[model samples]
Target: MEAKTAVNVGQLSRKPELKPKRKIKWKNVLTYAAFVGPALLFFVVIQIIPFLMGIYYSFTSWNGISAAVDWVGLENYKKIFTNDAKFFNSFWFTTRFMFAAVVISNLLGFGLALLLNGALKTRNILRTVFFMPNVIGGLLLGFIWQFIFVKGFASVGKYTDIGIFKLAWLGDEATAFWGIVIVFAWQTAGYMMVIYIAALQGVDQSLVEAARIDGASNWNVLTKIMMPLILPAFTICFFLTISMAFKIFDINISLTNGGPFNSTESVAINIYREAFQYNNFGLGTAKAVLFFVIVAVFTTVQVVMTKKKEVEA
Candidate 1:
């Protein structure tokens, strides 16, 4: 029995010598490669490579058709900056649109979120209804709204004798601008509401209850207690709206097509015209690069400001 016990002890002590737990470095590497390599390869090939080529082409006079690519050395950029009034007009329009879209969408979204955050029995149904518009394609939404603006409003105005609805919504420059804003805000608000709801859900109800118990008004509780807690949601929503409003394209094209004497052309539409419509690839690439830089700066500033608010909160 003693000898058998001694043999068992020896076996236990030499367990680490079996080498069965050895790491297969190649297997681990291959597993990682299997999961991530394809995505990385595609990103490099599709996005990174094209972006680099665009930068290169921006310095050339490539018409995007001929075999001969001529190097122009900042001439395209010079032309954009010096000779192109339409570019600046589009930029200004885009800037104004972005501001309107961001403010209206975020306000409406947050309002809806607040409304639906209660214990109402119809909250679920209302939420689905609100979010349904976001699922519609931008082009389709544009066309639908176009019909409503042109024909439906005319019919409603005719019957009701309302002068407000009788105005040419899409035919006029100012009204066309507002029309896009209305559509963009309507589409974007629901998506933002969902995000705000998520943020609101994560708040500590106990804090809110305690605040209410302290004889605080509903306004005070909401402004002081709830607002700070869910500020990160504001950051995210603002960022998304800002980016989307700045780069608005499909709906802009499908709805107004930058009509009424090019009053509603976004930078994206301008770049598209320069590249595909006009066949000036180099100039278009330059415009795109410039727009990318501007948007990056703007969004970076907004994000930094919002991040500071979050930290302070």
Candidate 2:
């Protein structure tokens, strides 16, 4: 009995100890939930819910205020496709404006970047000056430019006797289109310039020096080496300009109010009028949906094409 008791004690002593697993702290999870919950709630309430509701309302003939909302089943879209002349015209105008604005803004921005990339004494100050216009709201900028076009240009023309400045810039259709382009480029080019300058600074200076040593001219160096290196910046700038120009509203409204027989009216302005002015919420929502599709497709195509060029480069 003594020997058996001793053996049992030894066995018990040799056995390894085991510990209980720790439970997950629900407090930490609650803390994270407390932090992230409100933002998610607001995003859903503000953006997602409204967007989904707009989609539903697009198929209904709701006047936006009354409780009566009759389902129309694509009638709004059908009217837009078959009978909306003003909307189509505005769409065409917007398309043309987008093309012009993108090209001019990118070119000017790139040029400014090149000029500022050099060691100029006043480049920093000039960059700040150029970018200042972008800080102002588009609506405010439009109003400011309106005064310049109406009074300031007239005053300058009166003194300098320049026929170009004397011409009715906002009153005529062709000139109004170009006028908007000029203001848009002026406002946006600075922002693009800042982007290009950053990209330009990232270019390999040794490659440029090697090209220079190989008897390459400045033009060739820019075209062959710098352009390829900075293609990504071009892609970004083009995308931004395209999106902004496509959905332009404030500047168009404050500048010309789509006057001169609504010649300079954009698709955005048309949608606003359709919804608020004419009280056609369903049609407006339908136009908005179509606008969204066009913008998505165009930007996607642009990004894909530019990305392919980037890989080739």
Candidate 3:
């Protein structure tokens, strides 16, 4: 009896312990899916699918409405590289415009932020006034500026007799370029100012007080301390301005309409004319791809450089 009991006990000890498998909680998963499903569906449908179609179209000789899209391989790209003079000219114009607009807008924005950071009675009203232009659509703003450059400036020039104002603002190439720059800066500066103001407000006031007590000059404090602390804001503002300036289209269209012998033509306007006006969808898509590459590269470099400075500061 004792030996049989020991054998049973040994058998029981040798048996493997059973554990329950973890069941996937479908309820929790479904809850998360319910939240993320719509946005993910829209993103895939709207952005990803169109982007893929654009890439495919870039390789074909599709005239946007033809029955058949004939694959041309690298022909379009080859033409863009070797045979497209106007496209390259538009690219050059875009580059120059971007540099001018970015610098001027950021300077004005940062200056305004500094001025308003102080305890001014009218700061709230001034901020509202400055930012009002940004609330208006770019097309409307462009039209408004166009009117101002034409009739309003003509009237002001007539009264003041200023030669600068008297010059045909949108007719002459040089003046037209500067005129666009002025309008772009005016419209965008306020947006940048608001960003800079948020960054300025977050900065430690104690540091400024301590620097003042130490007899640090305003310039020194600004350059050494405040600028470093606000480096992230500069990064954000520069990135915003760079992208906006590079992709400038609506304002460029409504303001100048790429006029004066197409000297003021932007890459976006050029792309539009090529695709819709000229009915060369393949070539336009190719140009658009190149434009995207240039913008991506430039903005990436800018962000990387600024971030490095931010880390150092």
Model 1 residue 92 distance off true place after TM-score fit, in angstroms: 0.0
lDDT tens digits, residue span 1-313, model 3: 9999999999988969789899999999999999999999999999999888988999999999988999999999999999999999999999999999999999999999999989999999999999888888889989999999999999999999998779999999999999889988999999999999999999898999899999999998899889999999999999999999988898999999998899999999999999999999999999998899989999999999999999988
lDDT per prediction? 0.95, 0.96, 0.94
Model 1, range 1-313, lDDT digits (tens) per residue? Answer: 9999999999988846555677779988999999999999999999999999999999999999998899999899899889999999999999999999999999999999999999999999999999999999999999999999999999999999999799999999999999999999999999999999999999999999999889999999989999999999999999999999999998999889998789999999999999999999999999999999999999999999999999999
What lDDT would candidate 2 get against the real structure? Answer: 0.96
RMSD of 1: 5.7
User: Between candidates 2 and 3, which one is better according to TM-score?
Assistant: 3
- Give the clashing pairs for model 2: none
Ranking by lDDT: 2, 1, 3
Cα deviation at 208, candidate 2, in Å, is 1.1
lDDT, model 3: 0.94
Q: Which 10 consecutive residues of model 3 have the lowest summed lDDT?
A: 11-20
Q: Tell me, by TM-score, which candidate is best.
A: 3
Error of 3 at 268 (Å): 0.2
